[model samples]
Target chain A: MSEYTPLSEVGEFGLIRLINEKIELRNSSTIKGIGDDAAVLEPGEKQIVVSSDMLLEGVHFDLTFCPLKHLGYKAVAVNVSDIAAMNAKPTQITVNIALGARYTVEAVEELYEGIRLACENYKVDLVGGDTTSSHGGLVLSVTAIGEVAKGESVLRSGAKVNDLICVTGDLGAAYMGLQILEREKQAFMANPDMQPELEGKQYIVGRQLRPEARMDVVYDLKERGIKPTAMIDISDGLASELFHICKQSGVGATVYKDNLPADEQMLQTALDFNIDPLTCIMNGGEDYELLFTVPLSDHEKLKNHPDISIIGVITEESEGINLATKHGNSYPLKAQGWSHF
Target chain B: MSEYTPLSEVGEFGLIRLINEKIELRNSSTIKGIGDDAAVLEPGEKQIVVSSDMLLEGVHFDLTFCPLKHLGYKAVAVNVSDIAAMNAKPTQITVNIALGARYTVEAVEELYEGIRLACENYKVDLVGGDTTSSHGGLVLSVTAIGEVAKGESVLRSGAKVNDLICVTGDLGAAYMGLQILEREKQAFMANPDMQPELEGKQYIVGRQLRPEARMDVVYDLKERGIKPTAMIDISDGLASELFHICKQSGVGATVYKDNLPADEQMLQTALDFNIDPLTCIMNGGEDYELLFTVPLSDHEKLKNHPDISIIGVITEESEGINLATKHGNSYPLKAQGWSHF
Candidate 1:
């Protein structure tokens, strides 16, 4: 029989020691990782980029369907996605977690295992963090640090008129995956003996559970010597992010409805749910795809890229943001992003 | 009647705009504040020190007695105290907040008002952050950035045998204050009629509600040309932090029981609660005072200082950590730190 060890047995310092002993720092920029009041970093010529995000249990995730390991991975991935949206290379991260009394030492270890795996996959170092108790649910907040050459970073404000709009991969799969999960959860609640019908929806389910940040697109653009005029990750939805770029860059855009990329599985799932595929592609959130703009002169280099689609071109500020239908009709775009309040 | 605006009415981007409009970056190092994928900073010459802390609403604070403004101020101060423990000058901070749906825009502004006040007082910049909704309670995670010259930072591993152990200000006041608050809360719950019997407990109550980090001691030590060998903020009780220094530095310490700092109000409150004052000084937490060790040669510089008290001396590892009682008995000291888990 296993003996129970209350967290009070080891106290705060012992818990910190247990966790810190397993952390291995890989970045040279991280002069100090843990076991100190603060972590220290070496100065460099490149400009540093910092982004943070907080995920709450039951709000950002449901423990019933979201495993602790996947939650940890998603927390780090989302913060890293913010850094990647600036077209920079992530170097270090700090993760702060607050857990209720229900968590065990082994459970926290599993969460850290996922965090460590993400750090290894992204080549980012885990520098420092705080672990404390929560009143009720779990809270995970991650801060990502990255670097870009003095003027090489692509901000949301740099797009110019006639710039070609580009996006990586497809959209709406993650949103559809969430719909499937919620439906399955309701079915299980209604009938305890019912099995989850997740057989043919693996693609969408995986997309929702473990969305990957488009770091590959960032690297590809760098290798091709093409700097995006403006860039942002599709997190709150394609429509909202596009509006951010347009408002910040003081320009407007006209996107072709036919050019919007949507996976076949996502379209089928949207049809099954009685939702328009175009609406899903435009307003569904958490795609984690890279949406960027490149000058007209650099169009040829990206025209044949398999994973990228040139969907529109930047227009004058007065033109307003619009989506042109396949029927040759145009409608002004309105941002319908996710709200967590 | 108050109008209700569902967060969905404005969406995520609109909420971001609402918050960003109130932020004004004041530090020159804050090259970029918000609006981009990440905030950018330019720290010159000095080594950057990063410290983080998370405050959960029912764990770290009771909103019933703690004002939101004070909670915000306390969050920033706690993180700043960590930087001060490293003998660094705090320069900037990023605050991430997750609030429930019951919060209003005005309430958030009040919290920021307190944050801005603390930042202005400390000459620190509010650089960046993330704001989102929480499912249960409020959570605030702050990362403070500071700078110190190379080789000037004092880590817990730098303490040496025969060094003078020193503490700044009185301990146990915050803990005693907490006891008073808890008692009052119980009374309120039982009757819900009698007014809170708070009188002449202002000092301790304030200490618990809005404790200030001793950054002044850091500046004064530099001015006096006195560098501590090792240091840590007394946020986790004196005995517990001393254990950290001893374990990390591979040494032992002997503190005099009579030398423990205790405020008059704290002693009275402890007695009123039927608890020993010395025990409160030993194991009660959240004082935000400075506990440090200095070479014997430098003791004279601080000996005459009113706030600095030399409580003990470092010893060899074989001596173990001990406390010499006023009754002429020596006993091994055990850390009874706060355990959130």
Candidate 2:
């Protein structure tokens, strides 16, 4: 058995040494890590992209339904998704975690294990971070760094009229997954002996707990020799992200109601939660899917891509953003994105 | 009377609009901010220095003793200190804050007011950040970006044997200030009607509540044509930082106890608190002063500098770190740095 030395015993330096003892730098750009005043990165000849996200314990995730390991993975993945939205490759990340006294060394190790796994999968290096104690719940803040050629990065403002709007993978699944987890939590709270009804909801649950950013879509676009005009991640639902692209790019869009992709399980889950399936597809957040705009001439190349859906096309700003319904009515789109404040 | 809207009522988009409504980008390097998937910076031909710090409410500051405005100012100041330690000039910062339900709009404005003041004082742009709700107390995470020309930035691993070690201004005053604040807090808690005994403790109190980062020292060093061989800020304590420099530079140090700098008020305050003055000067943290090493030839140049104290010289690695007492006994130095964990 290992000795149980309280953090108070060694103070901050001792704790820093204990935590940083196992960290080995792997990237050439990482000139420094935990020992210096700040981690140094040399992003030679490439424009670096920086994204930061903060996750709170009770607001972002419930400990009852989310494992610490998955929480750590999701934190890194969501930040990486922001970089992926720029069509850049994630290269390094700094993770700052605030843990309460309730957590043990073993628990922190489990969290870092998930972080390590995500880093390995994404080929990103864990460069540096600050770790401290929290007065209450856990807080994880991740800053991800990515790189693209000087003029090659896809920005939200780059979309133009006639660009083909595209979305990768199905939406509304992560929101549906959250609903299932909340229902199970409520059920378990009401009746402790009741078994969780989670047998068939594994896919949605996994999406909620450990959603992967579509780096694969980034690679595929490169392989097909097509550069998107603009891109963003659908973390705050399809409709909200579409509005962002339109507003920033000074363009308008009309998304076909039927082309808003959703898995069958997602639809059923939304129905069970008394939420409109269409509304869930439009406004459900945390999907971690990529939304991009490609030139109309490149449509043929991506038209048959299995995981991608050609949802709409951009229009002149005077036309206004709209949703073309199955019943042939066009309604102006409104963003109902996720807000933490 | 002002209106009060529940965050859930306004939802996320409305909150984003409320927070970002007044923010305007002042720097050309800020290619994108809140509207984009990720903030982009164009650090043209300059190496960028990035540092992150997380401040929890009770762990880092008590609401009773710290006004929200000072807390905000201190938060930005501390992050700027990290960049200053690298011999770089801060250009932009991103602040992420998570607040509990009890916070009001006015309170947030107060916090932002202090942040704005710091930005103006430091000439740093408030580029981008996330504002979110927390489950418990307040948390602020600030990431500072700074610029340094190639080969101009200093690191902690450049000190050589026989190099003279220099420290700016005084040490231990902040720690003493904290002690007085705590004592007053306890006294006020025990007797609600008691007036705080804060008349003569202004210097130490200010040191603790609003410690300024040694940006002036960095600028002075540049003006004097003196580049430190190695440098670090006295955030964790003098001894802790010295230990870091020695370990990284592969050299030891011998600091003269008589050369240790301590403010008169700090010495008196330590005596009043029944703590050793020399002990406080050596191990007390959060001074926000600069500790550096320079070639012995440069010592004469800085000998007349008012703010600098040449406390020691680098020693061979086999000698180990030592502190020579005024009475002639040498003791092996130890780091009892502040512990948040």
Candidate 3:
């Protein structure tokens, strides 16, 4: 067995001192990072955007299959996704984690390593956070701070009729990935000696375990001088996010089934699980892709973008949100996103 | 029983709508609140301060005696206290909560009601949050955003030799309050039908359950033209926080035992519990009062303040941090704050 140091051996203050030694502040706006009652930031002329999200063990992830590092990265990524949806650049984040008695100092370091990696990848500073003990399982909450130029920020209530609806990258791979992992876990549980089969499922599994926020798409749109009329990250599935956009904007949308983007591995895994691919694409959560609307005039700028899919068009509220099938039949879309409750 | 609607019946979206309808944004800096992917704020010409804190059920509070509303209020107050310690005014807050299946819609409403009241009292906008179901008891995380003039913010690393050590209100009351509550709980467990006696302990008990952030002191200091040389909120006891300021500032402090502020009820409770009052005053946690240092020149401005107490003085690092007793005996201070590891 490897060395295991109980958290009690190094008290909270000692643990904080240990963590503080390794943190490096990356943002110029951060006047003071850790070691203060609160982090001080000078956002300068930019408007600040704040987003918060929480993930709980057993409900959000199973520690048996999910590594602490990936879980930490995913927690930050989900909060960053929210900031990305606002057409902003993430600058700083504060993470609050509660660990149970079973966790060791090494375990916390592993978790924080992932958090640090994500912070580096996203170019955001780990400014401040709180760490405490929990009685049940690990609980993590991340709050991301971002900045957007005046009048450049996007909102979910800006979509208008005749706007083109777009989505970044692909969806449903994460959902299919979750299915494969669950299946493997079930197989492993049934027979202790059997090795779980996960061949040819790396893409789907990775998507489920380590999703990335579409900051690239946000930057690309800015470089192309295109501002989204409305935007939301696909955390609660495509259909659910579209509902939020439509309801907030007082408009309806029509998405063509053929235009829905799906990764090859995701489609294969969905078929292997005998589930409808469209269901996985439209109702699967945690994709962290941006679902947005751009003016029809900007379609020419985005039409040839390989990573983007123009899936729908905004319509009057009376039209209702609908999905057009390959068979030419239109049906109202139902948002069945993951509901923990 | 009153109407009990399970969370599943309303779904996540429905619950969000219910919560959104009741939130009232109070800050002019809040450009957009709730509903969007993130909340937007325009902190014109001011530096922003961010603070985050998390509270876990069974760990931070005992549900057996702690009401849901008080817990909710305490969560916000604690985070706000962190911001106040930086000499900033809290402008906005984002809350993330995970509740178990046992929680009902009414229960959630009660929790939010307390949150809403805190928001009103602090004049902070409840801008954004994430709500999800957990497998265990409730988990709450709150991030507070505040603003201060670019050069007006205080840090724990600015104390200089000969600075006056000041504290707001009284200390040890909240810890003593907890002792009384625990005693009552044990008594109640021994005899379930016995009515709990809490008549004479109102002041101390209120201090424990509904501790307020010392934002009033921050404003008062500003109005009186006094900028603290160093400041920190006493969430982890006087001795521990003093250690932080001294270590960060590279100075030592001499606190007089006779000057340590104590509430009458707290002193009485300590006697009743057969605990040393000085231990409660110096090592007790979660008082939520401001412990700070100011230049010796500003002592005259603060000397007559009713709620402020001049407890000690900053000294050269070689002097060491010590507590001077009334008997002319001085002993090195020991920090024994709460360790939730």
Candidate 4:
């Protein structure tokens, strides 16, 4: 195989065909997919929801540890997570990628492999997008289209006083995973012969490298005939998302410190690094968990679910957003979500 | 004003609010805009058409010659042009932008100013997006959502033998404008006191810096009771787009070289640079014009339209795509569209 086939050799049309052949559309709403100026969808009676996110290299990830395939999967997963947060089922996604000339056909194929895998896993169609050259590094921007019954889609502003605050899966695992990866990268750079010290760190590392969107939770809740009054994906930490809900819903929340779910491996890694687990859970970003609220009457349906934890309850605006400690003390919660700049 | 206020000072939420406040939704279909995980739209009986495009600094635009305001407008206009290519009316757009730390709050506002202006001009709503910091340089990604009655949206594969090919507006002015801009930049760099030779060049320069999507032609066609058999936007070039239509429709085209439309200014500039005007009209990029085909029965309806030109006639696949010159010589057409990679 050639060490590197310059992208110019493939040309724009060749590269487009190369990527287009690999996509398999799974959504029935997709009337036409790719190979066109725009993707067409038949949404029918359902209202359509759309959201877009852009990720830049060096700002969002370090290439030293990030694999192109994993990066592609993460980009799609993160965007789908946003759709799930709206209590809407993602029907299609358009992924636009701009890459520097240093990449080869093989490199792009790897990235699309991950993207296609995620599309299949999420059961969403690969609809339309643009492939272009970048000045340098890789820039990925994804727009997800979803559908929900009119008035059924949830929003951050729907929470009210007495609403029960709940969260899906565990928090801070992805954050701890990043720290481990960073340390391993430094050691590997110092000694080219050293293998990564990743033993017993598989869970956390996987969380960081391939965090899954909580679509299962959305499905599970719908099956149980429950609707979250408010919902948001935990891309920017729990406390920060809580602030969004509180500020928008004109309410307050009190989450217990002990109730915050932390994986055993995540906690252990946090201790080893002398980083407080609570801080990681509160401030570290990219967990992709679901943070939502339900009315008090619906608590019985969710309390028994092992994947979910009832962490707190909503309160009047005067009560303020606070974190209640195991020691019975409450303090105002501050948001320190990822601020790349 | 504070000199170069670091973006870190305002945080992501603040930046979001700064841009969001300026956007006012004009589309009644937009049930919910920004501040939610996704924007909701009610398209009723119309089919949803979506398209996304990403623009990277240095690759898609040179900041030295392109102003931020025009760049933002161009980014959104280009994506809308894709939707128009499908014969759809764009309703909403989501814009995602990544900027380097060198960008000030003022710079971001200026970019959004252009975006808002384009949205207003196109009657599109600014529905949802993510704003984040980049590693360096500027990156803009826009997703345009449009709606058309079921079976009304045009496709590249609809053209049949004997269909009359039509093109809107003029071509190649944007490419010449870029050439003039590059020349002026080089001259200005070499001699600080030298003035730009851009007088009487507004038409070409406007085409390059702020090309508008041809939605006017779509409306006119609807009024004239004509539906294009096949349609595509002249983004890459007229020849490149015609190639797409031919490949998808399983037909060939015969375009008269003399019938291809070119602005007087564009023709003069091509002569000044010693560039073949025919090549410029056929292969130059960024025109953002619409190319479509109408049945012979509807040809008389469009023949009287001042802005529309009957450029060619479709032929059987066996004949091959060819161009006929004024002197009666014919040759196979080649699509040398922009291949930046």
Candidate 5:
């Protein structure tokens, strides 16, 4: 509707003000936000948890297909996911972004639009941040601060023998989504006139571009009075997360292939890409789902949940982490996670 | 000496473990650091302060003369300076870095060496961070967490008429040091055989390469029982920071040019470059000095401090910010701060 304004016209201070203008503090513990040298908070009776994540341009995302708004929302969601993994409710986040001269003020505003939306969705306060220039592409770094009740926070090292290993929602959808996007990108590069064949692929495509953090499941578990024995977010694939839980807890796991949830579109897309859907479920990253464990005694409380899938069970340390096929063969799981470096 | 190790040889996980090995938690509030999904802290009775900063290669630093270790140390110091600007004690920091493929494991370790040194010196714990790959140059983003007694944090919007404006340490040296470095770089390019004439220029050079945050001033003010009514760090020079305080506080001020502090090396280097030292003091950036305002009543207590200098007095809102010359003439001050864009 209007002409775009260059970032140089708005300057750093103006950009910061624009980013903070619509940010309403959702967390009461946030005493001050985004004006002074730092954000002030008073964590009255809760223990605080802090986590940070950095996303580079080419290293983390490709701007050719990823919308700036989705990129912004994904950045915040991923950091909030880390806080959720700690069984803590995220309260505040400080976001820092570096932009190249090629970016306009409108482009930055588009990115912040997604950030604001995610902040509202998560009910986290937008706190202090620094906006600086970058010589390369866009860089977003977010530090999330959350709080959990003392001694109630679930850790990766707390799983014990007979603990039920659970995962939230479906796995491999985002991985398939990435595959679809990559294939479309290749097709588009081969010829600029080719239309993307994305019909009926919305379920998997959305998972890749706009993955939601499993905070809803965290709330669900609390409401049902089911405390997980151990927890971790499924960012680095299901198999790698299983290794984290097993290694930290000094235990082993046995996950059944049939129990791993997969979206129908994800399976179809995996076949289209000539890849095994099982491999996608185990090794595909960027799911942002919760993979946690519960004590056997609390199994009755969690067994009937619609979205929660009891994928596996914790075993003795000597048993080793393995995946049992539907046909009765068992194989040790390997964590071939993403190596960004 | 041992040969340098390639970063690829160590991979991301090994590099993380290498960096986390020597970190010791100094704050009792840090329940957990650098292992799980997030760092855990329990700030029992204090309010928390959070700040973040991002430094991009070529945009914020030059590696030709800037040592990686100093870069690492300066990155932490600059973020900690923001916490100190709020009159809060820094407790923990999460450092996120993106290194290119050219970097070796030893290079990352060198950078961490400075970070470790700063963490030890500042008594802040290295909590958690994300280290990945960047397609361009290095990127370092640090988020510092600090704490203060409730209602004791200083802000930039609290200055009143007649508040004594003060600054810690000498100014203009950092700007001059940058000038020296740039000059030497040009000379070296012209004559590869010539040695850098850095014998007496070490003070000014060090000021530019490794500026220290003024946490000592915060401690000094507390010990002297004088709290600044308003405060800001001099990252973008004196006049710009003065404008920020005045605009935010809804007040005006007058500063005397003669009262500005200049290091001996800085003054000489400025003249050698044929640039006026007064201009460097007023408009030069990246000094990392603390500029603050104190109530007139506490002037008697703070006036005798060794590093603290009372440079000016705040005036009524109608009186506009002005700079009084060494002569009887006064002129309106313009804040031509650094424009990174």
Candidate 6:
């Protein structure tokens, strides 16, 4: 074991200088990045969208299994997912992080390295933020700002009756990944010498540890000239998000159980854990995939998209949100979102 | 004793709904507020500025003496201070808060009430945020967004030689307030039944609990046709901030000790604590007051202002930053900023 330099050796100002020295601004709208009271931006004619998220250790993630780099990446991706859900292009982000005294300068650099990588991958500039010390576990708060054309941004209340509902990518993988991690932790705790079995669980575990925002889908949609009528990211399960769109839009939805997309690995893992695959699809959280609605006329344009699933259709409010089975039976949809409280 | 409802009773979504119901959007630029994936804004033809801050309970404040409402207001005020330092009008803010399981619904409501009051006072719209549960102390993260006309924004790197350095309001008050609170806390800890004996320290205590951002001075300076060559908020003491301005602008500063402003209460309290009054003024933190520089030609326009003090003059970079005594003596200014780590 090697001795590492503690955070106190760098101090707050030194830490900020270290972080700032490596940051490169990627957006033209960013007038000032760091080393200022606030970051300045010139958005010109584009409307701005702002989203914030806070991740706390022991609540949002367990550092025992989650790497700091992946945690940092996931934190930025979650906020970017919100901006992408608004049908916007992310431009800048401010990260406010609190670290315990036990953390080292090298640890802080590793976390920021992941954040910097995410910023580069997403084409967003790292702007201003606050750095402070905490007595408890690590806490990270991120605020992402994005831009969209005047009339192109989508809202949760824009869905109309007869609209076609769509979901990007497969779901339930991330939640199952969390279950696998928890089980492996338990097994390791029971026997310290045990080699945890994780060979075939790479994909599901990756989904849980590092989820990517569907910004690519937002760009692809813009290039294809298809704007979503209503959009939201799947952070609190698909059923819960559907409820949000329906409630805000004063409409209802009918999603087919068979149409719900799931990764094959996630389905197999759910069965291995004696959990229903449909339950994982409907109520599992933190997918970071886009769930949206579009006009029925856009069906021909989106039907054959490789990664998109035509999951459902919007209906009148009186009809109620329902899930249709392959056996021609229907049941009112129920949502059990992950409630931190 | 009354029965307090647990935070778990409302859940995260219910808590969000409760908060959203009380919020009223105050800015026209806010196209959409709460109940969305991301808040939308239209800052047409204007440049935007963003600043973020995270305050941890044990690190930043002691909940035993500090009220929840004041904590929330101070959180907003500090972030807004960063925006003020950029010479911009605050338009919106997004708050991300993590509450411990011990916190009740009423406690959360009290916190947001303070945030709501600050938003109303600052004329900023409460746009969006994330609320989650924490295992440790309470955490409040605020991100303030403001706008300025193109080329009107001030940065810390603009000061040049011969520019007159100005600071708004008195300093050392907030730091002294913290001292008084700590003394009173210690007294209470020694004897549980003893009164606080805070009869004469109201002003200083208030300064610590609720420091206001000097947006009024920004408006006043603009009205009087004085644009600060450089600006920054005094969060980590005046001397430390002066170093930032000098380092960024490639200039030195010579501040007169006699010109350092301090409230009479703070001066008296410094003597009461057997501490040097000069130390309290130069090295005290959390003033949230603007320290700015203006050209020599603008002196006549700002010299008569009641709250503004002409503390120093920018000099050539080789001169070094110094403090001049009233007795014709000069000393190199040393700054011991608050280092949490």
Task: Pick the winner on DockQ between candidates 3 and 5.
Answer: 3
> Model 5, range A99-124, lDDT digits (tens) per residue?
99999888998999999999999999
Error of 6 at B139 (Å): 0.1
> What tens-digit string does per-residue lDDT give for candidate 2 at A18-137?
667766666676666667787666766677788888999999989898998999899999989999998888988888889887776667777887888788888888876788999788
Off by over 4 Å in 2: A1-15, A24-26, A191-195, A339-341, B1-15, B18-28
Indicate the residue-level lDDT of B174 in model 6.
94
Task: Estimate, for each residue in A22-77, the C-alpha lDDT of model 3 and write its tens digit.
Answer: 88888899999988999999999999999999999999999878999999899989
Highest-scoring model, DockQ: 6
Q: Candidate 5: where is the Cα deviation over 4 Å?
A: none
Instruction: Estimate every model's Cα lDDT from 0 to 1.
Output: 0.87, 0.86, 0.93, 0.92, 0.92, 0.93
Predicted candidate 3 versus true structure: per-residue lDDT over B144-206, tens digit per residue: 999999999999999999999999999999999999899899999999997778899999999
Give the chain A TM-score for each candidate.
Answer: 0.96, 0.95, 0.98, 0.98, 0.98, 0.99
In model 5, what are the clashing residue pairs, if there are any?
none
Clashing pairs in 6: none
| Deviation of model 6 at B162, angstroms | 1.0
lDDT of 1 by residue, B1-341 (tens): 66756555565566767767766766676777788878777666667788888998888899888888888899999989999999998988888998888877667767887888788777888777888898777899999888788889889999999999999999999999999888999999999996887799999999999999889999999999999999999888999999999999999999998888789999999988999898889888899999999999997788879888899999998999999988999999999887787
Taken in order, the candidates have interface RMSDs of 1.7, 1.8, 0.7, 1.0, 0.8, 0.6
Please report, as a residue range, the 10-residue window in candidate 5 chain A with the lowest summed lDDT.
A1-10
Candidates in descending lDDT order = 6, 3, 4, 5, 1, 2
- Model 1 chain B: ten consecutive residues of lowest lDDT: B4-13
lDDT of 2 by residue, B141-256 (tens): 98887778877889999999999999999999999999999999999999999998988999999999988888999999999989999999888899989999999999999999
Q: What is residue B182's positional error in candidate 6, in angstroms?
A: 0.8
TM-score of each: 0.96, 0.94, 0.99, 0.99, 0.98, 0.99
lDDT by residue (B43-154, candidate 4, tens digit) is: 9999999999998887888888898899989998998999999999999999999888888888898899999999999999999998988877888999999999999999
Worst 10 residues of 4 chain A by lDDT: A1-10
